[model samples]
Target: MSTRLRIALDAMGGDHAPDMVVDGADIARERCPNVDFLFVGDEQRINALLDARPALKAISQVRHTADVVAMDAKPSVALRSGRGSSMRLAIDAVASGEAASVVSAGNTGALMAMAKFVLKTLPGIDRPAIASMLPTMRGDCVMLDLGANLECDADNLVQFAVLGTVFAQTVLGLLEPTIGLLNVGSEEQKGHEAIRTAASALRATPLARNFHGFVEGTDIAAGTVDVVVTDGFTGNVALKTAEGTGKLFGEFLRRTFQSSLLAKLGYLLARTAFNKLRQRMDPRRYNGAMFLGLQGVCVKSHGGTDGLGFANAICVAVDLVQHGFNEKIRKELALLQESLQAASAAASGSDPQAVAQ
Candidate 1:
């Protein structure tokens, strides 16, 4: 029998957990036929969803935990103190080699804490940055530190650029991903000290300099670069703002469509065009976020995400595994670490769980 892409999903971790998670599982099954899902959560609740559906009824389940960590709860507390929580189980499953990937639309912090504690980061990767795809003019470009690793230094940002570049090449299928330091200006010395420092380091480094430079906020959705690297503080804000703007603009379009009979007629005439725009801006399409710099694949979904978001996250997981993300990233990271060491004539390490100093 062919081996399935085994995945353990946190059914009770997200805002729409269990119900949305279950529906997402169904969506994945219908779409990614090669994947084998194992929902980890309350047995009765999972069974209730499974029993409600015929195809899903045949799917498997692993009743790992009985509790859940709320969205706002601190991840350290949840991962450390909340014993046997659903998110913990899912991360533990991947760490224990029980599954190939772990999908959590739950607490971002909680999920990251558990994954870092469990699967662990790849060697030489100081921290695992979460990179989510953005709806850019050219297509989807990656924006790093979406919510993971809130406090990052210049070195960490450089590492993210290295990681993001490989992610762009392998996952996004970019031939030579243009690396950009998310900055206030395109000038080399434009951002914070950390950013300016990172830009210099990035330029000096051979691996990252491949189609590399600096990018400003205006260049984000405009597609000036393939990868946008920045500290978590900046990157997360940029991502959220873009998300909010997209939603608000879409709402405006909908309101305008319903404002008047003339507008409604315009909508009818441009119905196909509007549908295309909707597809491009749909939050569901870019719902997946890869926890970059990890040894194995850990794709994070939005906690408030629903069935469609879940499906998109699953597709992200499948694509990464299918394209061998871990293996590819390993080489790139090693190259970066080695080059940094050689160039500086000193050991510069990116150790996971390393002190953030």
Candidate 2:
């Protein structure tokens, strides 16, 4: 809290536009006293909302941008024509050092495209993967490549493990978080070649001690590992499935509680427990999805989320900034790169030093 962090908010990016964005910032202001906000959108609307919250307004500034990225905008088209859009300007703030991070509840693909183009990937990182936390029986689990790359090779998967590991350490406060590669089965011989190769590489490196190898889909909810790594296509599908399942479960519970007079009586008796369960499974608590591997922190909030959800996204950006998440990732990756070079040398029957060069 000693050093004030400036976070850029894409005021026109979300479904609710400046209203949700400003309300979210107000909530964030109460939680993070040392943080300042840069609201990028139409100055008039943003200021009008801020006027109602004098305390938040005191620590906020607005940058007028007439252009807004449509919720359904194509990533390709947005990248080509959204130069002065609110989302793009917010990202530019981070790249230009005007802000410590950028948060948006915008089109996921467009945000990813603009962020990658503006912030670029970290050194030794080929692509930035989408990472987010999932509520699990053992607390929370970190999963990556939620929807970044549709198809990834072995190397991409390897990098995702590294990214997920560092993220767990930084955010989850785990000294040695176990990692697993998502697959059809937990057997070593299962899954496609890319996943198997990635698993082998992870096991051969220093990360082997913390690597739990291949895990099935059920392992994700079971918290079989602290980090789950997979290609974007698979990871995205898993994420959506989990979301749908949560919704379906809630609906089933509602119907069961309303089935009959006996059921209604039972619901009253279990209301307290159900309340606790609802709090534990609140989607707002896990609204932020980080685009890891970018040079600057870029958090993507769910586009349709409410103010509370967006506020949680702001908190995520603050946590990453305070923890120096990118620095930790770079340090871990440096060590991993060295280990990989040594393994390559051993495979080729060459000197490790020469292979590194």
| Candidate achieving the largest lDDT | 2
Error of 1 at 146 (Å): 1.8
What is the C-alpha lDDT profile of model 2 across 152-202, one tens digit per residue?
Answer: 998999899989998998888999999999999988899889998898888
Which regions of candidate 1 are displaced past 4 Å? 346-357
Q: Please, what is the TM-score per model?
A: 0.93, 0.97
**Superposed Cα deviation of residue 222, candidate 2 (Å):** 0.3
Worst 10 residues of 2 by lDDT: 347-356
* Cα lDDT computed for each candidate against the true fold: 0.83, 0.94
Residue 134 in candidate 1 has what lDDT?
90
- When summed lDDT is taken over every stretch of 10 residues in candidate 1, the lowest stretch is 346-355
Total backbone collisions for each predicted model:
1, 0
